[model samples]
Target: MSKSTLKKGILQLLIANVLNMIFSIGTNFLLPKYLSVESYSQIKTYQLYITYVAVLHFGYNDGMYLKFGGRSINEVYNEEIQKNISTLKLFQFIMTICSVCVAFGLHDTALLMAAIAILPQNMIAYFKNFYQAIGEFKKYSRIMNMTTGLTFAINLFLIAVIRTDRYQVYLVGYIILSVILWFVLEYSLQRIKEFKPFAFDFSLRELYENVASGILLLLGNFSSQLLTGMNRWFVKGLMDTLAFAQYSFAVSMENFLNVAVTPISVTMYNYFCNHDENKDIIRIRELVIAFATVIVATAFPVKFILEIFLQKYLDSVTVIFLLFAAQIFYIIIKSIYVNLYKARKMQKKYFTKLCIIVIVGFAFNVICYAIYHVKESFALGSLLSAIVWFFLCLIDFKELRYSPRHYVYIFIETIVFLACGILLESIMGGILYITITIILSMLLLPDAMKKIWNTGKVMIIRMRKSKSR
Candidate 1:
């Protein structure tokens, strides 16, 4: 991708996510506060289960993503691609049927709903992966905006108009919306002028090839998801719905922080697909880390918001801070190490690293929870595992190397940040944390910080000029 195209794509995604964040403030925050703890817990349970629904595709979409990355969507829409999609659809349908049956047999509503959602969600995943792979981020942004807008509207109506406290309503609405979104995405793809039309040309050979090529990537991606959500899963299984709700609330807050970071990740993957310069990648990594550092300052205001708006979930505040601090490391692991591995086609190593992290993470959670028998330990364990994951990622950068200074910088940043958030426990502490972080950032990441300052100044000038015109 050209530099202009890259900037445009990133800008488009950022604008869309800004809208998403605005809408999500209601759906993610207000809705939970309005609903009863038990009701919200059920909704969170469904959300957790549904996230794993992507695995049903068995990597067909991932294979297409890997094969088509750095290319245009129009360039890759051939009979072979059609055959692969057809075969994958058929496979997904079979899996969905079997999974739904199992869920019904077990008499679990959440599992059944998640199983029913698999087909539509995986189908949408195919389109999303297509857009990301081909650098068609405008379409991706539209889909994101549409999903969040519809969701926020529906949630607001429920909270204000219906005043419904039943989790069933929210759960059913979510599945129905998924189906509708899938149809909309399909219609949009068909209207693309560059494409002829999709056709069902199922081929066993094509199915095998796509699955074989993408399965490792799919596993790696799934494992990464598992690593992130493992704590929530453990809480759900080990505790009551109320506890699960509180923990999920914390997780949700941490997820909202990703609104800004996700666009950078998506755009970076596209950039990496086209560029292999080590210096550029490292510089991007540092800037991204610096941005993550600065963003943590929002946690102070977030704490106050939760305290005033969702007072019932006040117990989750510390967990929220810990997760927020841990997120700094996770962002680097995700936007840097994982993207480079995929772009470089180091699928085997990527899969292996993720699997190791997942296993070690699981073991840590088990040990920590066993000893402390509290939710905080699980959150702490997640932080520790994330630190290990970050360290592991540094060992093999292929062409890039990090000095001892890099390690010390990240280590000190994480420890001091976490300490400030956890130990101080006041808004004033947050100010102190930000002050300390700024000093550390200037000392440790001066180059990245300088670039960010320059970029901010340029943006301000552009904004002023546009307004004057």
Candidate 2:
């Protein structure tokens, strides 16, 4: 795709995700407000398992991502695509059955329901990743918008119209939606005229090759995700359902902020994979960080709102504050560094970095819980892990020739945000943060800020010209 087309695609995704984020914020706030804490916790649990469903593919999708990135879907043979999907379907079928049996053995209805949802959800993920890999971001964004929109609609109907308090009802709605969404994706794929029905004439050799090629990436991605979610796992396992509910609620809040950043991370992967000359790499990185810093300012207001609406889970208040600030660090690693690593085919380094942080995150949680035994420890651990990963990424990012002063600025800015959130009241902290951040950014990183300002103006002009045309 041309640069112009790519920018338009990215812009489309940004707009879609902004809508998704608004709907998601509604769903997030409404669910907790309407449901009992225990019920909300169960919903979060199901969502947690949904994230792990990617592992069920065992790198099949990741391999496709690595292999087909920067290429069009039509470039691959029809038979090859069909065979890959068929093999994946068969493999996932067996895995689902085995998992269902275990769930039955455990006699957990929620586990059983989650196990059943895995197959359809994983299938949907494959198609989603297919579009992402092929740079068909419009298609990808459509899927995202549909999924989020449907989710919000479902949640609204259940909570507002039906007035249902049963988590099972919600779970059933979600599972049915997953199946429907999977079929929708399949239908869209067929309509593309390049895709055909899978024959199920599978190839063990192809499966093995894909798994081999992508296992490191899969491992790295999974580990990175695990590191990100490790604290939740720790809390869910060790604490009461009420505690898990509170912590996961904070995570849900964090997801609201995170959705806005999704467009850049998604678009950057495609861009970096296709383009080698990254002369503006540092500028892009700085711009992303600046965006993230501004994004962090939203946390204070969210926390303030949550204080009024979700009074029962006031335990999550501080956790929300910390996670939101931590996300600045997380965004830097995710949007800039991780994409850079993947685009450069630095799987080994990527895997190593993830492993290191996972270990540190695990230790941080263990030691903190051992010492303080508070839920906030988990959030602190996540922040600590993110900080560690941020620095580690900088260490390896030698090609950018990024100045040490910039590194210090990032460090200081993050600390200032956290300290503001922790030290002052919500409104006061927010005002102070915005003022300090604006001043520091203007004073210390004037050049980068000016570049970002000019780039934004150009992007706006180009978008307006295209629209007029």
What candidate 1 gets wrong by more than 4 Å, as runs, is: 78-81, 193-199
Q: Give per-residue CA lDDT, model 2, range 289-381, as digits (tens).
A: 788888888888886786576788776878887788789898888999988888899989999989999999999989988988889999988
TM-score of 1: 0.95
| Residues 276-367 of candidate 1: C-alpha lDDT, one tens digit per residue | 78888888888888877777667777777766766888888888888888888888888888899999899999899989999999999999
Off by over 4 Å in 2: 459-469
lDDT of each: 0.83, 0.84
lDDT score for residue 131 of model 1: 90
| Candidate 1 Cα RMSD (Å) | 1.8
lDDT of 1 at 422: 65
Best by TM-score: 1
